[model samples]
Target: MIGVDGQAMNRFQQKIELRDGEALFQVGGSVRDRLLGRTPADVDGVLLTPDPEGAGGRLTQAGLAPVVGRNGGRAWRGRGIDLTVWPREPGQPVEEALRHEALQRDFTLNALYSRWGIEEVIDPLGGQADLRRGIVRATGAGALVRDPVRVLRLARLASGLDFQVDPATLAWARAVDPGLAAGERVGREVLAWLTQSAAPGKGLDLWADSGAIRAIPEVAALQGVAQRADYHPEGDVWIHTGQVLDRAAQLGQGLERGALGVLMLSALFHDVGKAITTRWELGRWRAHGHEAVSRDLTQSRLKGWGLGNRVVGWTVRLVADHGRPMALARDGASLTGWWRLLDGHPCPELLFLLAQADSQGRVAAGEGEPSPPLFTAGMPFRAALDRWGQIPMLSGGHLLAAGVRPGPAVGRGLTLLRRAAFLGRWREGEPIAPLLRQAGLLAGRAKG
Candidate 1:
């Protein structure tokens, strides 16, 4: 076990040090975070000892649970520490094991290791210097080829840490075989980057720069697509999407992780259909019915990425109904219209946030500032939703119990009653006979 001169150790560190190992070094993000003066969220340790089995036995004796994986690697978990032993290969020198392990890491910055209770960092791959320079450099040419998921990780690190990718590493990422990475892995990485990063647009920019966006053919098609200059002075569809994503991230800072993910993903693909539906009509750019097209595209792309049904459903709904608020405002839609729109959506608040970001992302022609005219127009409608509850005041069960048959006519009558309630024409707790007569669901009683 390794010991230090004056530094105090936490429980996990103290317990691990009591084992009979040459050294236990804190590795990966834990070491890098400590050097950066940030609190490490998770600490992982690597044990270097000749007796691997002995080390595992000692950890188990200390009450740490052994977690075995499909690959047969053993990891010990306790007190928020994850400890793993490096297995020594047959006929390999023990001295070269550390360097060999370091080379297998995805990036230079993550290859760092620091011995427990010590001030020194083990930099076998020059990771410390790269960290100082704020650069994400791949350890070797085969780094990406070994695990293609590193491509998305490279983008995630660049955005999450606000670091720049080395030019050579970017080129290497572009030249690698795309089929080596699984769609599920890429989707998982993208979701992490979207939800966890301060500015996910930077990660997307890197994805575009590395040519990794081609994995989603629909997203790749967004490049160079034009929008109406009167509304979008931000150049092409891809540029506008990046801007909207950044804006949405800023707007959704305090939201729950799931809501934030939905908003960001919606913003990222809100305009995807422009690539397919854009056309020259009356000598200007127009994308009529693009919202529906975008929704279809979103469903297919997210399904291919292995996203769950709920996420896919919510994201597609957001994309499809993204323009409703503005359209309703333009048409001066009544309270019933707003209620109808909100009734069909899973989360009206998320849709409004996405709409706000969409409105704020555009640079109007001859205007230096981003004008959110639609957001201003939709404010009253949003306030009305808050005044009333999210769901309709009445239900189809009420109509069914009122002697209405369970069929298409009953559904239509319920919708009419809900609309009447929204318009203040119907009151709760009142006799339903009058409303049923108004809805043509009941024969009127002859008055005396």
Candidate 2:
């Protein structure tokens, strides 16, 4: 057992207690985080006791209700932390039980444990050494095969800690079929990879490298699609995806959890349609209508992952409009046009972020910077919109209030007024009767 100094245990005793001959130790990510000199978010522990009822009753008396876990252990959640405490069989020694549990874990670093109060760690598989060296080594050969979901766990740990997976363990992860993992387990890992990890792109690269990306066939299909060399000298669609994911990681820093997750997902699937629409037409590659295709595909995939309708709606909206900003800016379209596109959207800001990530990701080799006007021209419009705050649009009612009668001309007159407003030629609440007549909306007839 190893000892590490930590500060989270000050209220540990006040939170819970154990009966005689029962020992509880802080385990899993809590112990790993403390050993790395980082503060753990929560405390989770395993209790080694033959008397399961007594230990559960003690926790219940301490204001925690116990629920049965998959491993036949009692899980509890309360004011302080979440704990999954396993009971040792009859006549089992503390050392024997701890070692047995340690070996059953997925990774060596995660297998390390520490008792409450003093924080003494019990290492049975050189997990402490691996943690110090920043390596993710599995506990045993059968660990990942026994639970293929550990592949995602490995990816999460590697990305979260910025650690490298040991070669032997990585191979084992690669050999396992990721399809064996449950759907919800896969979805949770996907969320953590994007929302929880600082280097979310690394987690994706790990999935691709370890062959785990096959579990997400939609993403894997991006491996071979091609783009214009001058525009995207970054090899292929998959390579571009990694770069965009990394950029989203930078752009989404400190955002709210749901917003960050949505942005990352948008960046990931913003160009997924390119896989189907790319063709060598007009002497260069083009993915016409890729945004629409990507929007549909992204919706289907997120729904398949069992994401909430709100998340699906937000991500799909971002993907659908992610390409429009640059398209509008390149055509010299008014800022009002951009506003019209996102008028009723949930998160207008994420659209800008998604577009920025996509535009910045496609860089030609040897280029010192990626500033392609073809895609980056609209980035400035985002700041302009923010400063403009929500400008009121000239409605059809305003045109009708003028001399223009109910017809197609009313809609046309309304567009003209909005253009005039955007170009500083008109303002809201200004008299439009004279202007409508002067513009021939009333065929030059004076207003009655």
Candidate 3:
């Protein structure tokens, strides 16, 4: 008899039975997530039938537009449910089909299945036990070798579920050929970990531990790269990056998804240029102009991974300007400086958060205390923007109307005038003509 848990399955089963009397079994993530007390993101089912064509026809005749695959696989995609016919030789028994399908799955936790009206889970691979134990284990021998993409999936599951991978499974993942999967597929897996996991750095650490980081050469190069001890007591660039990424995630808890992704990615790739730009200058390490280098590398690597243009652009901008907030704060820069720093960037708040995280992630040499918060300088700067509004009192157009020629000189002149006003040298009600005259923009007398 169908139970409460099987109500959804009963409806699915009724539809299948009404068409061809075929049995549909729930499987994969749908069963595993539900068993873990988390709402499953998607539901997938397996139709137990030897006649793939007949199953497809029946599903179609039942008014479900099934996406039929070349290998005779069928899928009903709406309502977060997916249905596929079992892969079996013609005339194969349903029991054998179920067993073969479960064995082919990547991880034990994902190889679970349950049928409508059945109280027990159908687990031929001990997936239920693994799920209960909160472990990610391979289904059987050659599991990762069967599909190298599973190596990335292993990291994703570990990060997403906050579970540990079985030692043997990790060993198998380490041994798999990373080149077996294409870059786009591997990128998708890494993207999932970056965007979906609560602690993505842990997933990256697992990937590094499993030697899967070699798949992305850019990230793999971060290992063992030293940093200046005085500024970064965190040992190396790679370790500092992990701390920064986690700190960024913590600081960006309530951020929008796209903004959070950009912030995290910015932290991830912030110091990539340190690997190339590091040099022992005057008996200390220095990475002059690393920001520009890191920005270039970020663009190339993200494009290679096939990320969208918006993401690539936003991440590159963050990487390029990551140090600006800190630098401005240190210099006690005025509102004009802050405005100039945030002029092109759409999310200035995220940049400030990143600066704060970057500051907190570093340690003073031989000290246990956290780094001082440099981003607090943004407070006054933001207050100034809010008080004065984002619009400047004067523009290049004002200079042109004052007889200043339209050229690079006019742009430079207006920049100076704006800085003067932003620094409070010009009062709120003060006329711009006096400032223009003082700057020599006006010829003889100030016009009222």
> How do the predictions measure up, each by TM-score?
0.81, 0.81, 0.78
Candidate 3 TM-score, C-alpha based = 0.78
* Consecutive 10-residue window with the lowest summed lDDT within model 1: 1-10
Give the poorly placed runs of model 1, Cα more than 4 Å off.
1-23, 39-41, 45-85, 89-96, 116-120, 364-374, 388-418, 437-448
lDDT of 2 by residue, 9-100 (tens): 54445545656677778888878888889876667677777777666667776666665544455677664556667668777788788888
Query: How are the candidates ranked when ordered by lDDT, highest leading?
Result: 2, 1, 3
Better of 1 and 3 by TM-score: 1
Supply the global lDDT for candidate 1: 0.76
Tens digits of per-residue lDDT, candidate 1, 336-445, equal 77887876468888888898888877644454644444466557667757745633566777877776667886878777776666677766766666777766776546
Please, what is the whole-model Cα lDDT of each candidate in the order they appear? 0.76, 0.77, 0.74
RMSD to native, candidate 3: 5.7
> Which predicted model would earn the best lDDT?
2
Superposing every Cα of model 2 onto the true structure, what RMSD results?
Answer: 5.8
